[model samples]
Target: MVKKLHKEGSLEPQIEDMINRINELQQAKKKSSEEMVEAQALWESLHRELDSLNGEKVHLEEVLSKKQEALGILQLHCQRKEGGAQRKNVLQECTEQISVHNCQVTESCRQRKLGVQVEEQLENLMSQHKDLWELHMLKQRLTWEIRALQSSKEQLLTEEKLARDKLLEVERRLRSPPEVGGARMVNDGRRRWRYSRGRRLPQTVAPQRTRPAKERPAPSAPAPAARTWSRPQTHRTRPAPSPTPLLRRRPEIKARISDRPPPPASVCSPIPNCFTNRS
Candidate 1:
């Protein structure tokens, strides 16, 4: 019976130790559960933080793409503006050159107009000079003609004086009578006689009277013979004549002439004949 008590007592110590261990195990289980919950909460929190970081990264990438697109648009706008400015500069330069060319053309036209006017004035002056020179030449020619006329008048006057002197000398000799007998006869016989009445009367007067008398006798003799022959011939022609001589009558010609207009009164002035012996 004592062995039995000793074993039961040992079993009680073992049972008490098992109980203490079971209690310790239960406390450890409770602490392990609390640690697992804490771990779970931390893991959930880390997953949430990772998702937020991914969304932030996507947003940043979209912003960078928008900035790049905006930069490209700005660069294209600047290039277009630069090209427009260059074109405007070129147009302005061309406009300025055109204005300069126009100014030069206008000036050239003005100079040409002035040159034409000057040329015309020069031509006019030259023409006037030519006319003046021609007029001066004509004046010189007229002066020479006047001098020639004066010289001709002087020559005519000299010739007229010589003729008058000769006529006067001739008249003086003709009017002077010869001295009769003695010393005058002896002196006259020694001198040449230019107009002795006895010597020149036969040569100058006898020939003049004889020429007209001889011509008168010749015409008179021919006229009588012609009249005698014409009278017989006219008598013979009168009997054979038809109407030819009657158509040629002098009375018909006189009648026709009297039918014409009279002389003008200005040319028909009557003049008194002072040499007529009307008293």
Candidate 2:
């Protein structure tokens, strides 16, 4: 897309192309994330298999050592049976060793059966441990969810309290008579003030005087304000007008395939009318 945008050399096509590229990038990121998750799962399975294989290897090595120990005990028994005799016949020695082995075979078979039972018990315990681990993980997840829910409930309660307070304030305002802008006593208790349309104005502390209803006082005409609002100004002098600045809009150029090379780019600034003529 970048290459295509550079080749096109136009803003209009680049807009849509760049947006499409952004969407593609977002989708690609999601796809990569999913692939990463799958890879992680695969890695976990491989690690578990490796662990199981290692356990089996250890168990087999233990069984091999036990068998080697049994063979040593059998050899010792055969030597005791010989009892310092100079026996020349190999066949006679083999016959006697076989008869001795037959006598101990029953005990070896019983021990082998015990080993098998222990292996079965170990398997059962491992299964129970797996179940317990799953339950523990479930408990932790539920605990976390409960905490989150509790936090949300507390937040909701706080918001409800704030809303109730606002409601009470509004009800109080509605129940009371509306106040019109007039003279209000200050916290200082010395000077009186008034707020006309939210702007504070100084009030004089003079004695009240009554005038006849038919008598109208003659006063000078009020002065006009510079702006639409009658806001108090710092100075009475009016601001003089200045000439408005003029800016020329850049002409639009249509994309066309030309054999000639495109012109070099010009510097563009964000400040308004920086390139405009000052005259």
Candidate 3:
């Protein structure tokens, strides 16, 4: 209907109204482009703030690691101090034990010396006892010898007295002459006197008798009878006694004393485990 009106030249009012609506659309497009440019500038500012916060976190982590290392070094120094005290106590105990051992060794040496002295005294006493016993035996032997000599002297005295009594009896008998006739008794006395003087008498010394010529014997026959009666035996024989044996003498003895050597000493040393284990 509007196209029919324009062709007939009755449409001037409708054409002016179309040209005003086209100008209003152009102004709204220009205002939307200006708002998009402002939003892009705000996004760039937020990205720079996030990068600065990351650098500050890294620096804080390095500081924490250094503080932990310093605490560990302090703990190690405290443990070393406690170990030194324990070592000093062990050294003191070792010194005390060594002193006790030294005292025991000194006592043992003194006892050994005393025992040696006692043994020497006992040996001397035994030797003295043996000497005394030998002297007593010698005294007894001398006493026996003296008694034997006294008994022999007494026996000799008795034998001498018996010989003297026999001699006196023979002298008394000769003093009283026998009466055997006149001339015969006188002749016997003269013969005894001649025998005492150690002289032999002749056969013809008797007084001559007055005999006839035929009664006298031949001189040669009477000579043998006279010789047999002239000599008389006087001495007697006695048997000899057997001799006594001599006594034996004792042998000499020598004594010797010998000393014994001291025994060897033994020593033992213990291994030190404490020093080896420490290494």
User: Number of clashes in model 2?
Assistant: 0
What would the TM-score be for candidate 3 when compared with the true structure?
0.27
lDDT, residue 220, model 3: 50
Q: List lDDT for all candidates, in order.
A: 0.54, 0.53, 0.42
Candidate 2 segments whose C-alpha is farther than 4 A from its true place: 1-8, 75-279
lDDT of 1 by residue, 45-85 (tens): 88888888888888888988898898888888888888888
Q: Which model scores highest in lDDT?
A: 1
Distance from true location, Cα of 62 in model 3, Å: 8.3
Query: On residues 169-198, what C-alpha lDDT tens digit does candidate 2 reach at each position?
Result: 745654443222221212221233333222
Worst 10 residues of 2 by lDDT: 247-256
Q: How far is candidate 2 from the true structure (C-alpha RMSD, Å)?
A: 62.7
Candidate 3 — which residues are off by over 4 angstroms?
1-81, 121-279
Q: Candidate 1 — what's its lDDT? A: 0.54
Name the candidate, 1 or 2, with the larger lDDT value.
1
For residue 82, model 1's alpha carbon misses the true position, in angstroms, by 1.8
Q: Residues 1-279, candidate 3: write the lDDT tens digits.
A: 688867888676655655565555555555555555555555555555555555666665666666666666666665666566667667767767777777777777777677777777777777666555544444443344334334433433443344345334534544444222221133321223212111222222342233454644556543322211223323233222222111010011001001212121221122232212311
